[model samples]
Target: MSRTIPRTALLAALSLVTAAGATATVFGTSAGAATAGCKVEYQITNQWNNGFGANVIVTNTGDPVASWNVEWSYANGQQVTQGWNAAITQSGAAVSAKSLSYNGSLATGGSTSFGFNGSHDGTNAVPATFKLNGVTCNGATDPTTPPTTPPTTPPTTPPPTGGRADNPYAGAKVYVNPEWSAKAAAEPGGTRVSNQPTGVWLDRTAAIAGVNGGMGLRAHLDAALAQKGSGELVVQLVIYNLPGRDCSALASNGELGPTDIDKYKTQYIDPIAAILADPKYAGLRIVNTVELDSLPNLVTNVSGRPTATPNCDVMKANGNYVKGVGYALNKLGSIANVYNYLDAGHHGWLGWDDNFGASAEILKQAATAEGSTVANVQGFIVNTANFSALKEDHFSIDDSVGGTSVRQSKWVDWNRYTDELSYAQAMRTKLASLGFDSHIGMLIDTSRNGWGGAARPTAAGPLTTVDTYVNGGRYDRRIHLGNWCNQAGAGLGERPQAAPAAGIDAYVWMKPPGESDGASKEIPNNEGKGFDRMCDPTYTGNVRNGNSMSGALPNSPLAGQWFSAQFQELMKNAYPAL
Candidate 1:
């Protein structure tokens, strides 16, 4: 939605390890202002045939800095491939990792970590030295201590029976829905990513049983048992049938009316919670993505906000959204094997000053409502079914073009954070401050947000104008930040993985890549879905999208239905291209 008011910038404060290409750039390495001293710890976490993952933690031992960068050289012919939490670039044996907008500050003795996946032919030795802001650190790999070999596959302690693991996704295989897999494989080149794990959306009461002969919750969990095969497996269930769901967008409105809180609790959540609590499925780690786009609507779309909507005002007044989400969390979270992750709107929807803190407080209110507490929530998920980029390499909120801040750019529109990773991590910190568990993890739905086709920018845009600086270099190619339909030039992002960053639990494909966001034009259907102009490419604009073109793909099918054209486009533009 359009957030027109010019507000003060709020910088991010957390760490997230993300993927990036290997290119050489010199920004905050040798050119950076000097720091007193530092210490670096580099360790190989996992290894494979020809590739491995490394975690680097840097401690600033000197004066405090608003931002910092670390530099090092590889002894072997190692190549840095993908990284997160920091903007990394590599050339020959030398590499530089610069802090992002969130994790830049190092308050003398403060430490932050980022990780990357790299490749090596035979030897993958640790870097002997590291420099922070141009000053050499005390050590890289400790000289006194010998480096221990790491295991090839990530180790796993099988999830304890009838208990929650620190991270359910860790050392676990995510369940793949055969139904979606078959649909994807039926496409021309969909077989490439067809087997990827995506959430099984239970959007209505009929879906809880079986919608039109489709697999129900029990069937999926039973299939997960087959997939378990002695190892842990995560079954992702999207608990999405909230009353007046997605009030800000008509495309994904629910079957229940605004006041049907009781129907949502009994017919929808109770049945699903019963099935999950069954001992037969207790071995499987059940992850419920509870209520997508539900709570944030109460904060951003309610009365008195710039982007207020009548539908949202009604939902807020009735308090059903909060009551429904709270009841769902309490019921589902009570099961030891089930982990409930509430949906936190993406950065584009809630990264502004007015929306950010207020949204977190609203979440706290919901968590405590209906006899639920913060402990019921395992974590929070962000960027679900939206096209916010995971990270923006070219421009930061702190960057200025001709003395004009990038936050002032048309696309950024005074938003504090640039991308989803920073927003999720910062949001986690904010949630913990509001009495939620400090260790609660964050999940970023990476499906269809890659923006990594030929149009993907390689380096920083020219400094001629703030707009050019952000628009040219941004990985998200949508015309406006609020465009959330089947967007043009969108791509599949990083495949699902666990513990990829500091506070993140995983990068999940919770939103199946093949399903349409909404129909491009009005089409009647038995499903409760309604056509929203944001999905129509021909629609010129809305206040939510800065009154700009919708930037949607044409000829799209109804939401949750297969749009083969959009599926093919996602695969064609997928990052880490197939």
Candidate 2:
């Protein structure tokens, strides 16, 4: 009654078919003839870029030489765009493949192999109903043909059409950083150096006040309210400064000491609790307390630079800090969305297996110490300061090293950064296989990877293709856009028209725009110099120029501008209904 094929026959069928198609079978074995047995073996390998490669092995156990056919079905909105190795002929959701060239006469213990490449957005599964030489196989008395039905499409909702009714966050209130602002300033002519530090710091009160008092905050709330009908667009406040103000700061260079922990609780942790306690922003969803580490040494530093260790002790203490913070946030008893994520190094940096395992262990320990379980700790953020293969290679961790060793073989190459589609797809597959499928997500720094910063020197036409891949494709779901270094450049405008591919989610500006990296010590108008100038607009010249002239600094304001622009664009593309 059950329809099943033998494993050996399946492999032989697939192998013979693959060989006939000019594609090699990476892993598989042949079984006996298909007449006597009913076992099946198949694998989906090299899933990347909305496409995947598959290998199916089948065995025949009954009689002598005879022709055969294999059938299968796919779920989860999966569709076969193109295939190789075996001859694939599809009718709606039902796909059938056959061996054109048989491997001589099959004995009772013969086997065959077949495989092909496919494209899909959801789950992958094997189909039922197979036949050999017109004889219904798998011992099924009745082999009913699958029905032909067109794939279903997602629903479309219109944008906001009314008043406070249109406002997504009608009663919801949010706190903002008063210091936030964005703008570029003139620079003196010289060899410019980037002033953007490698880390982020936040003044809790200032951030909360800015959000509570500004029109920008209202705009964010409005946008969220608009999208509320679709799904919860929980407003998040990222407090990155912990232990140090910035990555390059002297204090940050030191390991996280007890003093750092104590100060963090008083200055940062307590204020967060106070904000959550307030009734106005009671419905707030604090998605994550992201610790943005800009320095390369944040993880494992081969350069021997000083790094902050977020070990078990620090994390445990921080857990108590968060628990206390959570208690305060729950004052309204309506704040149920607060969560935390430790910034894990980028894919290239974490490598694979051992390196990733070690970092994961540290995270697990920290989460446990925090008095929270791994479930409470959201996935790690994979980001980098410099968006290039050269910079990403500094921390490349792959699966090349044996499973028992710290290293494993390299699953991805940093050189693919320019290949946005390939890069995003590869990461999706790699992450899923590593158990981060559901929890892990990526935040891409759209600022520099496209045509800004160091990429300027290597610019080769617009990164429009890459943008489309990240924002207009199915693979963009796990990706969140961040303008890491936003002095100026291309890729800064609105989101494209087409909704991101099936799996792609919303886009947001992780990095606030306009903030300066620092002042130009060498060249004028460089990112470092731009950041410095923006921070203190009037302060001209370079670091050589003493910190004089005072107005609001650039970091906060510039960030606001970028954030506003990105949000608007997101509404345009993904949330037109909002």
lDDT of each: 0.80, 0.35
- Runs in model 2 with CA error above 4 Å? 1-206, 209-232, 245-258, 277-286, 294-298, 302-335, 339-342, 347-357, 384-440, 452-505, 521-578
How many residue pairs clash in each candidate at the backbone level? Answer: 5, 107
- Cα error of candidate 1 at position 379, Å: 0.3
Candidate 1 lDDT (Cα, 0 to 1)? 0.80
- The pairs that clash in candidate 1 are 1-544, 16-85, 17-84, 18-83, 18-84
Taking the tens digit of each residue's C-alpha lDDT, what string does model 1 give over 123-197?
665555578877865322112211221101245635444467878888887876766765665456664675688
Give the number of the best model, judged by TM-score. Answer: 1
Residue-level lDDT of model 2, residues 402-494, one tens digit each, is 222112111232223322323443454454454543533333333223322222232222224433322232111211121122222222221
The TM-scores, one per candidate, come to 0.73, 0.38
Candidate 1: TM-score? 0.73
The 10 consecutive residues of candidate 2 with the worst lDDT sum are: 182-191
